[model samples]
Target chain A: MALCEAEKTFILHSVEENFRIDGRQRGDYRPMELETNIVAPSFGSARLRLANTDVLVSVKLEIDSPTLEQPKLGKIEFFVDCSANATPDFEGRGGDNLATEISNCLSSAYKSSTAFDAGKLCILKGSKCWKLYVDILLLECGGNLYDAVSLAVKAALWDTRIPLVKSVVVDGNKVDMEVSDELFDCERLDVTGAPIMVTVCKIGDQCIVDPTTAEEHCSGGSVVVAVSKSNFSTILQTGGGSLHPMTLLESLKLGQTVAQRLDSTLINTLKQINDNSTDVGFLK
Target chain B: MSKKKELVSKIGLRLDGRRADELRRVRCKMGVFSQPDGSAYIEQGLTKVLAAVYGPHQVRGNRSKAQHDSAIVNCQFSMAVFSTSERKKRPRGDRKSSEMSIHLRQALLAAIKVELYPWSQIDIYVEVLHADGGVYPACVNAATLALIDAGIPLKEYVCACSASLANNDIPMVDISHQEEMLGGPTLTIAALPMSEKIVLMEMSQRFHIDHLPKVMAKALKGCKDIKVILDEAVRSHVEDVGCSTGWSNTSQKIKV
Candidate 1:
């Protein structure tokens, strides 16, 4: 995947001219195809393909005790699995490091209070609460994995439905919750504040979003800017190399602007998907 | 097991309304992905599996493992965490998955002409997206298609199927998950259907010693049926490719 000096210069010249290798402008995102309810038996699931990067996210709910430090708040955990289908290098424990890195990014993105409201998941406060396990499976890696994964997670959470707690009986020190028996009697999570990550790759003197793996190789440095609404939840500089402070600020501004548009477009796509009848998934 | 559930109804129908010798509907497609040399997706009833085949190229990693007389066959069987009704802790590396992988390699080795390609390796990876039953058999069948798509030479079509003895007299073929759980004595066989040779056979629970012949026969018959279906698919696929390339019409035209 190493590019020759001439090839690197070609990419640098393209970025400097405000055109990318994929023939996209610096701020334009890759065309994305999203599908929800692809996984059965899970509460909610979404599969997204951003260019060649493929991600499947599923949300499973479990009843567990709330953390002692956060008595009124529920928990959300992210787990990423890099399937060997993506590459032979991801076999066995070889993918563990990359999986951990992605999961860490996801968890950090949801840390800000404005990013996700964990309190809404609470049931019987400290005694009982619903734990949301967001499991992401990376099937293929073309590039811009962070952006694809974040979009999929947000769509899955939007599709998720928590059963209505009909009653909570607290007898002495014991408490039990009764959820509604009806399958459709559930509440959807408010995913408006869910973080949408934007990866800004610095190639040459200009910055670009959604870098393909080939473009990523030539990137001097990349910052993953996770924007929740109008605020920044987490900003992590990933991959090799360094960037100047002024460039970092400029990238952040670009990331925020692109993420806001991404969030609105994603919400509209999900709404349109709900009205559709068929989901082809990988079968197509 | 209180009053063990009946695998066959009073009217001689299996749990899924299939006949004693019927297989669950199998639908498959090859060349599903571009990364692997060959890839395929197969669905046996509700169970879905994707298989990918890579290489007969130079050995990866350690070079000492290469054999001069035969190519190495490596197989991995993994199930998605959300594939089943309950979530799995991990996809692969479990003892059951390891055993399944070994069994897959054994079955595939019988059909692939490995001796032709020495000092090389072939990697077969199967991922189960849905796990109803007959997971191992589905993986074997999927891998066979993928290997063929990779343009590797094979002796014959290798197929796997499961059968069970019901009511001590009736032999059922192509056991589904529901029937597998309630049926008595399940037997699975992988074979070269065209050659009428069994490559591997696995059994669970127990059957009367006298019933072995009947159950095994039923399983082998199921494999033959599966081969017919797979052959039809391959023929159609080849025809489709030929038509796209104008060979189907132009070749005949050139002859006339």
Candidate 2:
């Protein structure tokens, strides 16, 4: 939707005044509810609902050979499915494009060795490694999809437990590994330094942290920043418009600052979720 | 499949302890999401399915596919990778999923009054969150609730149920995943309960022609029982929706 000049100005003024149309400030996030270990059959699962947007993340683990290019590094892949439950527009293959876009962006953000150490996933160098398949399902789209998806993925990964391997033996080209029999004998991934993505929507002359559907439609462009604990992992500009160099630099600064707070809040919330609680799905 | 016991017997009751014609417990909630025009979640036994409806909008992609006489009914059947005992590689568009999607559309079209909105399109999406058995029937029932929640006109209530001939004698209704693996010829039927007409029917494995009449009749009876459960759910949902909208008026009267 192309907003008229008057509507654009009104939105910009509202953001500057610290009161959005949905009664949230520029720095305030929408009401969010999260639950973990909902998909019982998965290694780990989490579902997050931020206002109207809903995302379900499930993690599955498989044993596979490490990539030849990075033998020491195990693999982590992201698959995003924008289900038609979010909207009928996603029927059939309609959601494929959006799903691919989100998954590709996530892969780029986490592929760096320093960002997420895949080496920890290796049971035997070049022989056997744990491949983490992070599957995300988008059930509804209210707004701010990027933030909701990122949070759910991080929570699901934190809940994942990798079974401990007792022994590994290699015979020529054959590799054999024995996993621990005890159900509780497992290793948990250290996800304190995981990246959190924040999107800054530039509407008129103002930049807002979390934009609503109406504001998103009014914005001319937006910038997505994926920030780890100490540094920015990836920066990408979306939409068809170009931002001036100074404006782009300013937006990056905003994104990085917001992402830092987001990362801390997510870590604390996930810890509480790991304490064990029942999930109510969409009932709430 | 070798001769496994048709159903494990314990005091003349099947697994989970019900009569031969009994169905699994059904619990459902409608209008579950705000984004979709209509949404519903249903649980039958261990099977959980969510159905959502979108549109009466323009035909997406190639416009030529739109029919002039009636609105197009598009159906997509997807199961969560973790829904099964063994994880699935993909959710939809696979051979089984594609076939299920086609069958769902056929059964729904028979019930939906499509002539009311010509040249428009309606999309029904069913997501299986957990699959124990009889996923097709669960999906159809969930979709019917979602369509009503969306206020789409229907000719009649469409309900689906499955039946099986147990040990070549007793006819069982609402077979669970365990019963399905116990070696029996399974029959699934989707029918209009009011009209007493079958819209879609299918069978797996083999059954003698002489036994077909009894098996089919049992399946139809199962459908009728399911239809009553669904109708109750729809009525309760409507009451809830109406009360929420008239909350102020109702509250004022109570205060008076």
Candidate 3:
């Protein structure tokens, strides 16, 4: 991963010309390949490859009592597992810190009710609720991990199907609920308000979205902006370097714009996914 | 007796319609990731595993672990939290995963020619994306393919498989999770297929001593079969790359 001064200068020069080293515009993203419903028996699953960064997200649901504080709202938990396959540096417990940071960011991004409606997951208010466990596995780390992880998580949530509750009966604190027996009779999560994150890197005083690993190395600082349908859900500055207030504002603007575009593109692809279609997963 | 009848059906088919000796269909691809020196993905029945090999570079972290006479082969075996029907609490650093890592290193150490690269280390990591049984064997096979992709020197291909006694008489090869649950005993073996040398052998549950030989042989046979399939994949992969690179390595492809 070491880049000598000459290579850094070459990258800097390319960025100044409004062209990235990969012949992409500054605001452009790498080609991405996405597949959904790959993990069997899970409520929903998605595998997204953004260049070399590979992410697999799966949603699993379990019935449980609602939290005392959040009585009416269901729970949504994000777990990120950075696999050692991504790099030798992530061996054993080495990747736990990064995994925690990513999961926390996701939690914050989805905190707003406008962004994600957790109330819909509640089954019987305080008595029972459906807990959605959104597990994300990072298989590779090319770059722009935040953006790729968010996209895959959004897709997985969209694909998740919550089984219909047939009936519920309560008798003297004893509650019994029957879930639907039919497999296909399930309700899909409405993900229209889900947030999409975009990473805007400051490379040589210019902001660029979707920075590759090499670009990330040459950049000074970056901001991750998670944008929902109407407003920015979360904005966080990462990496070691500092950013000026003006540049930070500029990066946020850029991130929000790019995130909007990315969200629509993702929705289009998700809609195109069909079970009868021959092209599904790794067969290609 | 009633439950035992389910392992092998009334006619001859087992669960998933495979005969006792038949292995689950194996599909694999090499060079899966660009960051690693070598990487591979493998699917055996419902189980899927990804393996990546790094180094023969300088030994990393705690130089005391380095060896002067031979390269150190470090291994880590981890499964995704959502890989199975139930969520796993931890991916690695658990007792089971640590044990798996040690077993994996032992199996690979037997085949890797580590003496040639003194003061260096090779790291083999396997991530199980799905677990339906035969996880150890899948990890070993995927690592072998990744090592081959890395152009590492090896005594021979090291492959592994799991087998079990279906009834009192029939021996099943490449046992799946369902079969392992129904069957009483499960035997797993890792071997240098060409030399027919057993690097590691493990048996869980009890089986008659007479049944041991047949089940072990069946698992070894499964390993040999896997090696052949892997060898074919390697050759075809090399040929494809050669064809793309102006056919200069045409002779090399033939030799393989």
Candidate 4:
């Protein structure tokens, strides 16, 4: 992914002119294809492809006791695995660092109650709750990983169905509950406030969203902003190179506006996705 | 004592309505990704796998591991965390995955023409998106297709299949997860179908030694059948690509 001087300069000039090597404007994203419920065994699943970058996300639920600190709140954990099929460089333990970074970012973004309320997942306060295991698999890397992973996670959450508890009884220090046995008798999670991440890359003097691999290589620094509805959940600076305070503020504004637009389009697309449509996973 | 469940019904149908010798519907596609030298996706029943091949290039990391006589074939078998009904804590680097990786390498080494690329290496990676059963066999089959997609030379197509004895008399091919859990001896084999040579064979659980020959035979027959399906897919894929590129390497007089 190393860029030669001439190639870097060409990308830099393209960004300065408000155009990209892929014929995209500064705030425009690449053509993305999304599919839901591709994995059969999981409660919910999604696969998203942004140009060459591919991401798969699945949500699995398990019953467990709530933590002592948050008895009324359920648990949501994010785990990211960088598959070697994406690149040979991710072989063995090579991708651990990146996986950790991405998972940590997601956890922080979902930490705020306004972004995602964990209380709704609780079945019995202090005794039992539903633990959501959101597993993300990185099948390919074409850049813009943060944005793609977040979007896929949000879609998977939207597709998740929590089983309904018909009855709960507390006897002594123990808790017992009866869960509905019907396959489709479940409640869907509300993901309207789920955060959507946007990566703002600064190439030359201009900031761009959804940079390709080539564009990423030519960038000096990048900012990742996770926006939940109209509010910003988390903002982090990545890569090397420093940014002026004024420039940073301007990039934040840009990321917020773009993330809102992306979020609305994603919700619309999710609504239009027909449940009966045949799933064409990787075969296509 | 509790009554035992039948693995095969009296009418000669398995739980999934498949016959004793019938394999699950196998569908595959090659060249799924542009970044790798070769990539492929395969679905055998509920089990889905994706494989990618990168190499025939210089050795990476440790140069001392490079051989002077032939290329080193490296294989990795990984399953997604949510691949099974129960969520796995990690995707790979476990005992079962390491054993699978070794077995995958053993099977692939027999078919790949390693001598042509001396002092180099070829890395084959397989990711399991779903694991109904016959995971190792699916990984080996997917790797073979990915290697072919990469244009790497091979002695022949190496395919794998799983077999199990049902009702103490009938042998079933391509065992699914439900059947595997239903108390039966399962036999898996990887073979060079063209030459009818067995590359690797493994058996789990114990059965009468007299049934070994029949189960082994069924698995070998399954391998050969899979080879045919994969060959047809490769041919059709080549035809599609050739037509798009105007068939530069193909002779005009020859029927495509």
True contacts kept of each: 0.19, 0.56, 0.58, 0.69
User: On residues A160-274, what C-alpha lDDT tens digit does candidate 2 reach at each position?
Assistant: 9999999998988988889999998988888877788888988777788878777887777898888888788888887667788888899989888899888888888887664
Q: How close is every model to the real structure, measured as TM-score?
A: 0.94, 0.92, 0.97, 0.98
Which whole-number lDDT from 0 to 100 does residue A233 have in model 1?
95
Clashes of each: 0, 0, 0, 0
Per-residue lDDT of A1-284 in model 3, one digit per residue for the tens?
A: 89999999999999999988999999999999999888875899999999999999999999888989999999999999999889888987789999998999999999999999999999897999999999999999999999999999999998899999999999989999999899899999999999999999999979999889999999999989999985999988888799999999988888888998999999999999887755335534
Model 4 lDDT at residue A151: 98
Q: How does model 3 score by TM-score?
A: 0.97
Q: Who is ahead in DockQ, 1 or 4?
A: 4
Kindly report the docking quality category of candidate 1.
medium
Q: Quick one: best lDDT, which candidate?
A: 4
lDDT of 1 by residue, A1-284 (tens): 57899998998899899887788898998898999987776899999998788898999998888999999998999989887767667777778999999999999999777789999989987889899989898887889999999999999999999999999999999997789999989999989999999999999888999998889999999999999998999999999999999999999999999999999999989988753577576766
Please identify which of the two predictions, 2 or 4, would achieve the higher lDDT against the true structure: 4
Which structure among the candidates has the greatest TM-score? 4
What is the C-alpha DockQ of each candidate?
Answer: 0.52, 0.61, 0.68, 0.83
Per-residue lDDT, model 4, residue A251, is 97
Better structure of 2 and 3 per lDDT:
3
Residue-by-residue lDDT tens digits, candidate 4, B160-225: 999999988899999999999888889999999989999999999998999999999999999999
Q: Candidate order by DockQ, highest to lowest?
A: 4, 3, 2, 1
Q: List where candidate 4 sits over 4 angstroms from the true fold.
A: B248-256
C-alpha lDDT (0 to 100) for residue B215 of candidate 3: 93
Error of 2 at A90 (Å): 2.2
lDDT of each: 0.89, 0.86, 0.91, 0.94
